[model samples]
Target: VALNQQPRDMIDLHARMFKKHGITTIRNFDALNDLRNLSYSGERIAEAGLHHQIVITIMDLPPGCEGAHTQEDYSKMLKDILDSDIPFHSVCFKDSSGTVHPRKVYETIQAARKMVPEDMILHLHTHDTAGIGISQYLAAIEAGITRIDLAMSPVSGGTAQPDILSMWHAMKGTDYTLDIDPLKYIKVEEVFEEAMGDYFIPPESRMVSPLIPFSPMPGGALTANTMMMRDTGTLHLYPKVIKEMEEVIRVGGFGTSVTPVSQFYFQQAYLNATQGRWEKINPQYGNMVLGYFGRTPAKPDPEIVKLASEQLDKPVFNEDPLDILEDGRPAAEKKLQENGLAVNDENVFIASSCESKGIDFLLGKAKENIRRKSTEAAKAEKIVAPTTVASADSVMGLREYTITVEGKAYQVQVAEGGGNPIVSTPVPAQKASAPAVAVKVVEAPTPGNILRLEVKAGDQVIANQTLLVMEAMKMESEVKAPAAGTVVDLHVSDGDTVQAGTPLLSLSS
Candidate 1:
């Protein structure tokens, strides 16, 4: 989905690149467990002389939510993989969310072992976000899983794969063995920590979240969502949004909570929380439920399907998603040529996937964004009240001035006769009051960064016409006019961050 060119071009490019980098194996899986989505890619990888590890995503749906991620669901996927005759050397039971129950993991792996050839490698990959990764891995090992993903400390143990040392320790005296040196791993951890000392590690990434099994968010997506919320000053809404995810997953057809799908669930949950429940449906969420991605494990709720159909203005589609997407190479090359860039495969792919930013990179217009720790400390400021204040010296009995320190500006306000500023009503200028006009102030429905303004001041718009676009939780939302009016004032501009109910613009009928 990140690539621009045709699927054929994208698959070929990636397969060749992975081989060039000495990668011998590629684990490929689709979020919806659609074999159709993985078939071509698997073939390409095998044709490229790389081992293809076809994957079936695994997760336990939030308790009381059902119809998918069952033993039958996994067996059906395995059967599909085998029946498709797609080239593969291994199979992976991957749970990015770390929400799979231990018994279910054991049963699935044991069952998979019996189905695949004896030589085929069976791998298990999961995170420790819910603090059950190690237990799940143990279950897999007992069920004859040959290989499992592991990480080292500092980066491990929280939202990452189970730490190698911890797993090694857990297997002590058991028939199974990790067979690695602890001293070497300690040194590795020390060096890794030193190398990463300058960067700020988000606290959420470092701590295990007990809520993962409940909401079932993947580790990578959880950190990403949290960081975006932190940047937009909406971190406080995270818990409420997470709580809202239960209903989204329960009703939205339980596709495995992995990327694209995971992000869709998260974005929808956020909207449901900030906006009224089901007030606004995320486009991707709407599309997924409408079967645009592929068949979800079970049928989605009919009410949600209807809501999505109406909101997205698209009918339900059940065909393979890959067959629906138009070939993008011709358009990509045309765009590259229009921009006077060489229409090579590399340029075409870049333009196709990266969109404008890719074009900017080709044209040398891309700006570098690098974050580094600041070395200089900010200096403190001391504020002192005036010894004697005159009533006429201040504007409306209040004083305002800006102070600059270390290249940063700080606005300061001083009140006259300030032991504590006394409340006083300001006198109005000696002028007649203006006539009252019917004006409507349009406020933001949720916190987001303003993407663009569709209607500027004095622009006449009809009711329900889009007035501005907002980016929230990595999704673009159109803010429409509530009624017909002329936009009289804009309180915000493009790229300004706004909170829920913050005034965005004013309209006069």
Candidate 2:
């Protein structure tokens, strides 16, 4: 959380003084990147026994806007802030620029919710310039925000939120489990109304979040997410951005980020769109952090906007980028082209998707699609092909199997032929096994040794459908299917090496 906002000398002075006085301070860090500097600040915070707070600042777009707050820049900033460890007790998304859209705000908060844990408090502070601030507040509530910063006076043209009455009413609409009472709120507001007559009170705004009914976005405590997405104009590729996030989480990773890293993720889309190149990730340090920002789009009804605007005595603006050209004034793509990042015949760069995902996934997808295409194709390529169909049927007990793995090949010795099975090879037991009550086949979870076959070919199995287990990572993961399928063949015996993306066992359907 040690920041590099002001001059390094000033920070050094503070650090020295803080240490000398034995103060338990919270280091407020600006740049969450810059490892050498971040490390130094982290060391200082640790030595002082202070909690570090991070507030990642978004990069101003090359061209400045009078008051536009860019969500993309905020996203990048938040991404970078969470990417590094600074003993950050809390993170705040500050709207240094007053321009922010309601929809973008909703999406940004949701994305932030996913980036941080419940224990980590997220905060937001914004200057209202196009009047979407109240909408942003409502979006925060729906997006599961708990903490916010409001000023006593209206900032810029609009006011700081949580106007006692408005916040109290909004809380009533929310199912949030905050311990409180609205009657106390009404009593306080009555006293304030008498003391400060005609004090400005903006009405409660509509939700600014995108409608993600199936899987709701998480954190809304900050505007860093909103600023990050909007700043980058990432609202355009909203779905893809969220998709990358889900995939990252699936791989046991989180999408907490920093500004520079956020820029890296969307650089091709913005700065170098025509170049078609992505930034390289180095695992030595940043692998554990960085990448991906998302949000639920805000959908505030115009009639509602009109109602709120009239109440606040201010004009409420639409936050959707599509509206930029709603009257055919200018399209976002056209704006990009105007900015000189558009693709032309000259600036084209070579790119392909297969490089990162590998040919296997693509081929697997194509195979499934082709099989599903037509009955003729499906007849030729089965969804789950039986060993009899995929290969010539081998004898039940006597089958010679050789497994090639990695680059080294292993010769597997299998037991063969009834009474001859006992002393010839590995000791093999011969039994009738309940007349094939259930012919369950076991396959490898990942490519590894066969280890041990818990059940024989003709053994009865319950509905749970477990046959064999494989060892991967550090623990033993199970490989199970249904109990009804016929056990056609066991490819390898115990203690045989295998490769990933390799099929080890075949079950008859």
- Which candidate gets the maximum TM-score versus the true structure? 1
Candidate 2 lDDT over 277-322, as tens digits, reads 1222211112222211111112223343344344334443323222
Which clashing pairs does model 1 show?
4-352, 4-353
Which runs in model 1 stand beyond 4 Å of their true positions? 1-9, 20-23, 338-340, 360-509
Find the candidate with the highest lDDT and give its number: 1
Q: What is the lDDT of residue 108 in candidate 1?
A: 95
Least well predicted 10-residue stretch by lDDT in candidate 2: 347-356
How do all models score by TM-score? 0.77, 0.32
Q: What is the C-alpha lDDT of each candidate?
A: 0.80, 0.39
Clashes of each: 2, 38
* Model 2 C-alpha lDDT versus the unseen true structure: 0.39
In model 1, what lDDT does residue 48 have?
90
